[model samples]
Target: MSLDPDFAILLRASADRLFFLLEKFASARVLVIGDLTLDEFLTGQVERISREAPVLILRHETTKQVPGGGANAIYNFAQLGAKVLAVGLLGKDEQGKALRSLLEAAGINTDGVFVDSSRPTVTKTRISGHSRQSVTQQIVRLDRKSDDLPDLDLQVQISQYIKEQINSVDAVVCSDYGDGTLTQPVISAALSASRTIVDAQKHLERYRRGTLFTPNLPEAEFAVGYAITDEPTLTQAGQDLLALTQAQHILITRGEQGMSMFNREGSAFHIPAFNRTKVFDVTGAGDTVVAALTLGLTVGASAWEAAVLGNLAASIVVRRFGTTTTTPEEMRVALQRLLEEG
Candidate 1:
């Protein structure tokens, strides 16, 4: 299916404006605070079925570690040309060191990332099995994360960092995977920033008074404890969330259904997902969206315009495998391609 004719026309008309916003990303300074994680991919060649069990034996191929969770958001910001500062917790382990090295290699400032020896660095490992001549297929995943909070004193240090640095950046982005890095004190500290954008896993209400927060449809349903089965229900959920969060804007990301935005002023806009082609993987797509959206807002784009950039950015990342980011050049080409195909 194609987009509504009206939307296609609006997007076509504003294509140039969107390009201008992308060019301005270099000047924005962003602060990201949340749970940092390392996403590991282990790929091996599928050999034969195991004699002792109904399992396939595999020959090891290669391993990869990429920024994930909030770290991905930081990577997106840095990739998109913004000067980025990251604040979070990491374990005093090799994963933590590797994750920090990756962040620094991408040019993200990690001075605010503190070490907590009590817990291990958060990691998500995806194991894949593949034939010698075929694409790798993910077989299973292993997760190492903690729900326990950092020491109260450590939280205080993080809060103090947020307070001191929040004003220096153009915006503060809180990426919460509910890993306890964003405790109440930390959230309060981040809220002090005038422009705060959040990508939270749950408890959406805690980001009250934020400039914007992006939650997918399932998260919305879970937070409200109701299904958004129709337009009326969706509208009510939007209003309910706006009131509950006291945010200036709420963007509900509806996967393939597209994304809808609601503001405190009672106006809403729906942007169709530009998934005009195959989607290989959706890993880190939300991070790309929030990164582009926050940078757009920082550079003075209207909410709708920023959402359009975010949407286009996601369209680019989902076409590839693994966690990745898109550049301004890629976004421009995507817009033109969408127009040609639509």
Candidate 2:
């Protein structure tokens, strides 16, 4: 699909405005609440086959760890120079301490982070060889969580914290990775307190008014409770989600098919994915999109402009493997290049 001609024109006409808005990212304050994860990558060379099975054995050489999921969203905003406050549950373990330290190092406020002894901090491990192919992959995934809503005391604390900060921040982003941080009580607190944007990782019905919900194709389908295989069906699904969530807008990330946005007034806009020579890993591309969208809104960009900025940001992160965040300079350079090409 080609870029939307109207959107292209809008970008050209508002280039100066967009630049100004993006510059305001430095002053915007954002609050994020959701799942926090640690992404571990083991990279090595595939030089020999396993003796027991017909499998390539990787001689591991390097290990790297990065913040992932909702924490990644917070990191992205911090990279853009925003004042970010992150609230989530973490276990009392080495991984949890490391994640907290990482957040602090990135200049994110960690006051809202709470310790939960029941669950170990979530972690995802990936093993790749020199070929960048999955030679052997194992996930030490653990979800020591409960679905029961937060207790009255915890709910009160969360509500009070939001009320205290809502007026100070430009916007709130709900990065729901289904880790249970965004419980019903938390969603209710967000709804009653401020203007919010949600990355509906899986639970869609939790959305409410004064919020924007961004869900990928599979998530949108689940939100609408049907199968979406074509443009028309996808459009219908978007409308259905808008009705269900009563949100101001719904942005559906459709991978290579690009993304489409549906507003409360029933209007929709589509932006095709930027053509990339290679796509290494699309792991945290959605986080990049949601982070860009929240910051764009914070800087006073229109919904359409926010989506465009988001698409541009996602285009950059997917080219690299594993979880990653986009920087302000990178976004500015990419937008400038796009304008020059046009």
TM-score of each: 0.96, 0.88
Candidate 2 local Cα displacement, residue 320, angstroms: 1.1
Q: Give the runs in model 1 whose Cα sits over 4 Å from its true position.
A: 49-55, 133-135
Top of the candidates by lDDT: 1
Mind giving the per-residue lDDT tens digits that candidate 2 earns over 1-342?
Answer: 234676667678978877877788898888888788877777777778899998877777888878988889888889878899898877778778988999999999999888776667776667666655655444333333455544566656766687677787888888888877777767776776467888866767767684899899888887777999998898898888888888889999988878999998979988878645455679889989988888888888898888988888998899886788888889898888777765
Candidate that would win on TM-score: 1
lDDT of 1 by residue, 209-309 (tens): 88898988888888888999888988898999898899999999887778999999999988888884466688889999999999999999999999999
Give each model's whole-structure lDDT.
0.91, 0.80
Model 1 score (lDDT): 0.91
Report how far residue 55 has shifted in candidate 1, in Å. Answer: 4.1
